[model samples]
Target: MFRFLRSLVLPEAACEEANNSSRYENLFKKLDLNEDGRVDIAELHAGLKALGIPLGKDAEEKIFKTGDSNKDGQLDFEEFMQYLKDHEKKMKLAFKSLDKNNDGKIEASEIVQSLKILGINISEQQAEKILKSIDADGTMSVDWNEWRDHFLFNPATDIEEIIRYWKHSTVLDIGDSLTIPDEFTEEEKKSGQWWRQLLSGGVAGAVSRTGTAPLDRLKVMMQVHSSKSNKMNISSGLKQMVKEGGVRSLWRGNGVNVIKIAPETAIKFWAYEQYKKIFANEDGKIGTIERFVSGSLAGATAQTSIYPMEVLKTRLAVGKTGQYSGMFDCAKKIFKREGLKAFYKGYVPNILGIIPYAGIDLAVYEALKTAWLDHYASDSANPGVFVLLGCGTVSSTCGQLASYPLALIRTRMQAQALLEGAPQLNMVGLFQRIIANEGILGLYRGIGPNFMKVLPAVSISYVVYEKMKQNLGLA
Candidate 1:
């Protein structure tokens, strides 16, 4: 872990290779688009675009002022390099603080407590930001290499600083105030069309489902297998499944899971984006509170649409008595026998828990990313493996904390079908059933293992996905 963290704080030979290449010198050549040795607003924005960083008007002015050491409203090679180096230093500091435990690494639990102590309360957007940053492999954690590449060494820090510097300059230019259009232009709206949103959502869902199926299956087994019964642990359950059937038994209801994942992921990302846009400033910047609101909204929306399917998936995965044939069969049977209300058996818990789950997931993602970009100004990719692992661990821990209760409730509701003439357990009914039979503690069953299972799954998934996206230039 310390090695991983170390990587995030340093840079590779190739990354700094740009220095030998006189990358900044080349950038100045490009920015002098008119060969006039001076940059106007258009020229500055074009220069930013050349570097793959688009800036709004306010951000543009700040960059021009900061990089234009001559006060001539233009950037020279020397000035730009200076700006890049300063930006890199700040990013290093943020990542250093993120690795606050001094254990040479970061974990989800560590991040959560750290944020709480830092008085940096998180919201969903912030969580997503953190997750997306550290989740280089998209498994949601920073492996050593990923932590090094992205979190420890990012190009965006320089890019962002340039923009912020310009924004401040622009504000000073226009009556000491920064102005942004209240709504997206027609072109911007077109860029964010519904189809694109749908595609992103679907992809996220598929990714998450594909990554989490094995763990999800194990979790359900742990939940449904009666403690008094012979099956008391993951190993016993695995042994029983393999003994009775093949290894395929472990994937029992994965079919339903795959189908459900696309919509689930789609809804989650879509809702999150919309919520973030709503609560953020016109310029699309967000604070901790805004991030939380967006994340919670996204979580709630996704859970509401897909939770019933989650229940069905769990039912089909468990109860090997040949009760259900497939996802559709399970759904059909549930609807026919228990009525539509049965689909939402754990709606209350599921919906409420989703708020925190989504919120923390997205917020942590953003925070980690911001921290990464701050530290590594030379590399375009985020912190490498170690950073990714740290971010992932932190994100999953928070998600588990906020969602555990709901998970337990949902499990009980779904498990009702495992018994003969499963009870008509709604949210209240399930609560009563658990409390009456096993006392309040029953609601927290398997929490320890659940955390262990979910945190790693989430961390790894985010980290892996991020790495893939960055390689594709998506991040």
Candidate 2:
């Protein structure tokens, strides 16, 4: 009769479990360590310890006093469950608050601010801890789905899908060499991803640039240092480097850059090829509009991955007074002081210019190459190094002319970030300052040396890349 009455008042599941060999009652009795018919602070501490919960004495006291009604200093099963639900609710609220920008994603910046609010001032170690906490997907950025599924939705379900998406979105892909194969399928003949062909043409640029990162680093250091000291010419800069820092200093940061360059090139080039292929017909030919689209996307892809490395290389190459030791040290300090996103400084214009730069570069290169082939007899072999050099030289001149303005902006933005009180220069601010201080011509300040370096670099690079491609049957 008592069991029936209890079942009528309490939940069926709870009541059934309670009377099942008195196990539930035994648990409750164990919790009520003093047999006082309620859980007091001391009894709650003992119960929590037995359950292996790490509730410190203060926490145990707080929970016991809060949950215990009528000064009983103890909790029944219902009280225990209610307390758990409350704790879960508080945790859910806290997690939701961390999702700043309300974009269903929480970035590291948001995590840092949220930590400050929680009275947990983060050091490098603490920041790393918080980053580990929020970056559940493990790709760095904390997206909304990751946050929701991790803390709010399903804590136990495998989060591979969320992480996979994060990886896909964040890290850039350098497409396959044959992605915009010389031929296309019948279905592709209809659906127009032809722009992809042009974009994929960036593969060549990526390949070419990837090989010359050492020289590129030298060039950046030279430009940054020279421009600041009014030593504007490339020859002058090279001379100064040999005179002051020695030739070895010219190749500083080359080691770390090697690993980055190839992948960066592959991604940009693949994207350009894909874009171009989309716009072109089966013949792999494109018009002006297709050219623009392909070039833009290709430039953007290459710049994004390489930007951080570019920044590091610049710092390393320009280390005249021991500001930094090496690329890794520079990267570490930047990440610790400013965080990871600083690596992508000046990403905007750099990416924006990539398309036109790539388009014009590839277009001119192919056009010149074709013209040279025409110069040869029909059955004659294709152009040799001199002809290849001429074609590459022309292509680079055109690309540099088109890209110099944006390049100037990018350099200023990257360099200024290293300055003490240098007003944080955005693309707009840089553009405006360049125009105001140096006039429109100032935008092309580095164009002369840029052209000089680009010509030889492209000449050598294309020859190597084409030869490699041909030898490998990738062409």
Candidate 3:
């Protein structure tokens, strides 16, 4: 009431203070494109676009109506202030609504009920996970202070900083599995700080791959031998591998796997950035379709550049110890015995597989993130760390599932023996042969071990990359 009275009176002190706040003054000037010091509907849309709020016409009309009081069809300085105040009040009311029974604290059930009001149906466990994040006391509840501190004290409310952050990525960026969370200055990048970032990513990748090497080798073994001779369970696969060479055999191909991480990451990340620029609008906004296209192309480029290493890796994974001593030995033998075509035996299937994998992974991640934001973003600007991990895991698993058969085929074609009179198989021929010989299930050979590694691989890779960035003072 007092605010209303003050606005009516148009106090000189408050007006002067607001005018002096430079940040708001600049925003108002930008939005007042006509130099009339008032923001019209078109100008408001322009400003919102610049601020990275990608709302449709209906949402724009709803937002415009809130600030254009007295049906002026435009927002003056006082009206803009009123809009900000009203938004703040709405946030407060939202918090209070969650803190039902006037308890000044929000519990998991309250959160669940609040989301239900928004037509968001989530399990109690999911609700509790959300609550526990903001529940600073570990009491499974958040008091008023916790709520205010967690939600209201955002640096992004400053508008300028928020615009910068939003410009980075409106939706989450699905980086290569080895991505580090860091930003570099132009000068730092010119000085090759990116090399350090790439090295950090390589180190993280090596650690993760080495840590999960056994499961990976197991996956390869299953993919190659699951349907041939005797069915290879994880136990029998391990026993066969150990019997052939020893525990060291499990890491046979890991050298190439670890080595390829650096270039693949560097190329994919660099190509993705370039491709995003090619796809971006004048305002630098990329739609989901553009993202998928750019991501697919980037992935294809990287994979093509390093595919020979992929052939080498598969060969080593299945090679008996005496067959080839090391990476160079394996490459030399494949080139000499089978010719250069051996390196690209399954190139067609590999390319087809990667496009869908990259597209589906990015699409699923964006969908999940958008859903979470639409339904549960009232109390926070960013989703929790666990939410990110869960989204990545599920999205990656879905992508892998979609592309697994092609992947299995590619690996088989890579590791196939070049024997006299053996049939040369293209993708269709291989698919027909596998189905005819081993049934359709043969195409899904190693999916069990592949899936077993997905969650842990994503979790460990992300956690380690984040930690490395933090340690390097880049996060």
Candidate 4:
């Protein structure tokens, strides 16, 4: 009778044990590519890639180092279980230490104190900014729900069961890394998550584009109206826009800009996945170079499919009050006057720009991420959110710098009309004219707003993406 009463109240342990059994079985099958019940670094990477989690080489090596307690250079079943249990305990303890009052939420002051405890000193303002992204309730504090949603949403492991692992022990690791292995353990695949990555990326793109629509429109305006005759600068242009219409005018092209996200992300991902397989060898994994090639081609294909939407977006964004009222209105008129081919006016330059932009962006981001892990991240597994944001902003800025001139030219061609008397300018002709008339500086028109949009845009997108993954249980 006593045991039955206890079991009724404390059923979570048995539930977690069952979950652990299944989770371990799935992970062992997937990570042990050779079916040897042990996971090597290469197989671990391959498995992670399949699960849609990306990681740096240095981070992967570190996980291996930490997990391989016996120093065998591989992780057996027992070793993996121990690693999970250890990390889960650390996470829960971290949360508990942050919640000094023993209340469910970690308040603004508590977060500040907790960061100091971890030796991560930041101003109160910076602390608030970082916490704002994870504060779901708008109560200015992070509750257990918010905390779990933000950091404990790994699909590879049953973080719910991991919570049980934590409840059994209140102790934690203060100096260890919290970076979870981002591999697709066999356990995650059973839930039919093959399509989760593409959907998540699509959602991220939509959120990012919509958030930055005003800046994107400003870019178009600066691109098309940077001449002395127009008397247009960023300040004057924004003032003119608000004068013509209210602040709502800023989002004119956002509708079509948002709609293309799904198909584009889906196609790009599908193409990229296929290309990865094609490039893979007997090991069924491809290197970064092969990944880059696959991504570039996939981007081009997706861009071509929705090229018309981009043209329409540009037109609506730059249109006068009477010219275009909405996305369909602009599209119908452009189709009627300029016909279908006009939608692809700057197709070549746009396509060419993708090569340098993506190449530089990926190369720089990966390089910086690995460097950060190698240098400053020796003690911890996770590099933290701030580091990821910094790397993204820096890499995006570099990419835009390399490809800005080409981007400027493409915008001009798209905004140009297809009238018979207008001079037809190929890319070379356009480059020559801009250099001769406006000098090389003309090619970098409107770069200020573009750069301004990068950091916040990337930061918001990443935060939202992680939250969504957790909320959707796809993390």
TM-score winner among the candidates?
Answer: 3
Per-residue C-alpha lDDT of model 1 across residues 1-475, encoded as one tens digit per residue: 1123223322242253435226445545666779876556687677556544465454455456556677866666677668656755766555555566665555555555446443345343344445454554455444434444342223334223212211101000000001111122233244453344344334444555555555566667766554433335666666776776567777787677667655655566567668767886765566556655665666567767877877787787775746677778888888998789778776677666656665665566557755665555332333454565555456656666666767777777777766778665677777787678767666666555455555545444455554544443334
The estimated TM-scores of all candidates read: 0.54, 0.47, 0.64, 0.61
lDDT of 1 at 279: 82
The parts of candidate 1 lying over 4 Å away from their true place are 1-212, 228-231, 280-286, 355-385, 439-441, 452-467, 470-475
The candidate that achieves the highest lDDT relative to the unseen native structure: 3
Please give, for residues 1-475, the per-residue lDDT of candidate 3 as tens digits.
0112122222232332444345345556756878897888788777656544334453455556666788888888887767655655655566787877778788878866765543344456666666665665568786754554343212122222221221122111222231112333343466464666666566766777877788888888888777766799988898999999998998889899888877887787788778878987885655546656776787788888999999998989988878888999999998898889899888889888876676676667667865775677654435666676677678878888888889888888887773235477878888898999899789988778777876666667677776776666445
At residue 316, give the lDDT of candidate 2.
69
Write the number of the candidate with greater TM-score, choosing between 2 and 4.
Answer: 4
* TM-score: model 3 vs. ground truth: 0.64
Q: Arrange candidates by TM-score, highest first: which order? A: 3, 4, 1, 2
In angstroms, give how far residue 472 of model 2 lies from its true place.
6.9
Query: Which segments of candidate 4 are over 4 A away from where they belong?
Result: 1-190, 194-200, 418-422
Positional deviation of residue 404's Cα in model 1 after best superposition, in angstroms? 1.4
Q: Provide the lowest-lDDT 10-residue window in model 4.
A: 170-179
Report the lDDT of model 2 for residue 437.
Answer: 64
RMSD of 3: 14.2
